[model samples]
Structure formats: structure tokens, C-alpha cells
Target: MDNNCLFCRIVAGEIPATVVHETDTTLAFRDIDPKAPVHVLVIPKEHHADVVTLAQNDPAGSADLLAACAVVAETEGLLMEGFRLLFNTGAYAGQEVFHVHAHVLGGEPLGPMLAPR
Candidate 1:
């Protein structure tokens, strides 16, 4: 775990978060800043700078993350209904947080492109 990372702190229980789901490989929590009504972040226990690094360094972790994302979506009532999953890889992609996390967003129809931050 990255000691300086916020998501790592959340995974370690060193920080408090409104957790919606958790498993052996991942943790799902409400986003502090929500874009949608049901915005949540699903992160792996393992520390990864970003999705690219994760996919390169650990294929198992990548698979686990994808599975966890599916689980998070299902648990949040977004599966089958409709939901948007996002993983910002770098600064250009709006990755403010370095930790690898899949953003699960739903509860409303997302019709257009999201504004760049």
C-alpha cells in the first residue's frame, strides 16, 4: 500500500469512507465528490499508480479489478439497468488520484460527454 495515497488509507481503514461493498480483493466506497447520484469508486487492495501500470505489472490484479467493478455495479443496482464505469489513467485523462480505481456512476441517464477537469 502507498502510505501517502488517500485510497490506500481508505483500504487500510486508516481513513473513513462511506463503503458500499468490499471483498478479499477490492473495496467500494462512495466518492467524496459525486458526479452522479450513485457515484462510487471500486479500488483494489493492491497499490497501482494507474490502470496502465496495473495492466502491465499484474494481469491477475487487472482481472480482479474488472471483476470487482462488475460486483460493485451489481451491488449498487446499476447492472442491467445502466451505469458508466470509468478509470482515468493519467493527468490528461483527469486522474487526480494516482491510485487505480474504477468509478461506478448511475442513477440517471448520462446523455453527453462529461466536462474535462
Candidate 2:
């Protein structure tokens, strides 16, 4: 775990988060700044800068994250209406935290994936 990483701190129990689900390899927590009715962040316990890094470095952990996201979506009652699982890679994508995380969003109409430009 990167000592300076925010998500790593959360995984390390140095920070507090409203955790919804946890497995041996992953964790699902509620987002402090909720963009939707159901906004949870699912992350691997292991540290990786971003999804690309995670996938390249730890394939099993990447699968664990996806499994955790599915469980979070189901637990949050987003299965029927569907949901979005997003990974904001870098600054251009507005990834404030460097650690890889999957944002599970649903519980209402989320409109489009992006604004019309």
C-alpha cells in the first residue's frame, strides 16, 4: 500500500469509511459525496494507481474488484433497474484518488454517461 494514498489509508484502517461489503481481497464502501442515491466505491485491498495498473499487475485482484462491485450493486438494490460501474483513470477523468476504485452508481435515473458537447 502506498503510504500517501487516500484509498490505501482507508484499506489500512487509518481512515474511516461507511463500508457496505468486504471480502478477503476487496472492500465496498459508501461514498461521502454521493452523486446518486446509491454511490459506493469498491476497491481492492492491494494498492494500484489505477484500473490499468491493477489489471496489469494483479489480474486476480481485478476480478475480485468486479465481483465486489456486482455484490454491491445487488446489495444496493440496483440490479433490476441496472447501474453504472465506473473507473476514473486520471485527472482528465476527474480521478481525485490515485488508488483504483470502481464507482457503483444507481437507485435513480442517472441521465447520460456524459453531457452533450
Candidate 3:
């Protein structure tokens, strides 16, 4: 784990986060800044720079993260209405943290996936 990475610190219990769900390989927590009523961040326990990297290096880990998404959606009561799973891969995608995370957004009408440009 990168000692300086924020999510890594959270995984290590060095930084505090409002955790919602956890598995042997993943953790789900509430996003501090919520875009939707139910905004949760799902991450792998093991550090990976991005989802692309995680998929390349650890397929099982990637699967675990995907599995956590369904759990998060169900727990957050977003399954009935549906939800969005987003991964900001790099800076251009507005990825503030280097650690890979899937943003599970729902709990209300979220509108279009992207702003009209």
C-alpha cells in the first residue's frame, strides 16, 4: 500500500472514513461529498493505481470490487431504482485519489450521465 495514498490510509485504519461495507478484499464507504443522495465509494483492500491496473494485475481482486458494487447497491436500497457505477481513472476523469475506487451513485433521479457540452 502506498503510505501517502488517502484510500490506503483509510484501509490501514490511519485515516477515518464512514465505512458501510467490507469484505476480505474490498471496502465500501460513504463519499464525503455526495453527488446523489446515496453516494458510496467502493474500493479494493489491496492498493492499485486504477481499475485498469487492478484488472491487469489482479483479476480476482477486480471481481471482488465488482461484487461489492451489487452489495453496496442492495444495502443502499438502490437496486430497485438502479444506480451508477463510475470509475475516474486519471486526472482528466477527475480522479483526485490515486487509489482505485468505484463511485456508486443513486437513491434518487441522477439525470443524465454527463453534462451536455
Candidate 4:
């Protein structure tokens, strides 16, 4: 785990977080800033700058991350209602935290993928 990474800290129990689900390899927690009624952040316990890095460096962990997201969706009762999974990779993508994580959003109509263009 990267000492400076926020998610790593959360996983390590160094930082406080509203953890909703956890497994041997993954951690799912409520987002501090919620975009929807259900906004959970799923992440691997291990450190990875982004999803691409996680996929390239630890494929199994990457898969675990995805699995964790699914578990969170089902547990949160958003599976049948539908939910959106998002990964912000870099600065332009609004990835404020460098640690790789997936945002599971649901609980209401999310509208378009982006604002009117």
C-alpha cells in the first residue's frame, strides 16, 4: 500500500471511512460526496494509481475490485433497479484521489451521460 494514497490509508484503517462491504482483497465504502442516493466506492486493498495500473500490475486484484462493486450493488439493493459504475483515471477525468476505485451510483434516474453539448 502506498503510504500517501488515501484509499490505501482507508483500507489500512489509518483513515476513517464509512465502509459498507469488505472482502479479502477489496473494500467498498460510501462516498463522502454523493452524486446519487447510493454512491459507493469500490477499491482493491492493494495500491494502484488507476484501473489501468491495477489491470496491468495485478489482474486478479483488478477482477476482485469489479467483483466487490457487484457485491456492493446487490447489497445496496441497486442491482435490479440499475446502477452506474464509473472509474475516473486522471486529472481530466476528475480523479481527485490517485488511488484506483469504482463509483457505483444508483437510486434514481441519473439522466444523460453528460450535460447537453
Tell me how candidate 1 scores on lDDT: 0.89
By lDDT, the better pick of 1 and 2 is 2
User: What local lDDT score does residue 88 receive in model 3, on the 0 to 100 scale?
Assistant: 98
Candidate 4's residue-wise lDDT over 31-81, tens digit each? Answer: 999999999999988888999999999999988999999999999999887
All candidates: CA RMSD (Å):
2.2, 0.7, 0.8, 0.9
Q: lDDT-based ranking, best first?
A: 3, 2, 4, 1
- Write down the lDDT of every candidate, Cα atoms only: 0.89, 0.95, 0.95, 0.93
The worst-scoring run of ten residues by lDDT in candidate 4 lies at 108-117
- Model 3 segments more than 4 A misplaced: none
Task: Please write out the lDDT profile of model 1 over residues 1-117, one tens digit for every residue.
Answer: 889999999998999999888888888899998999999999888999999899999999889888888888887788777999999989999999899999989989976666678
Q: Any idea what lDDT model 4 has?
A: 0.93
Residue 57 local lDDT, model 1: 95
- Model 4 Cα displacement at 42 (Å)? 0.5
Per-residue lDDT value at 46 in model 3: 94
Candidate 2 minimal-lDDT segment of 10 residues: 107-116
Candidate 2 lDDT, tens digit per residue, 13-106? 9999999999999999999999999999999998899999999999999999999999999989999999999999999999999999999999
TM-score of the candidate numbered 1? 0.92
TM-score of each: 0.92, 0.97, 0.97, 0.96
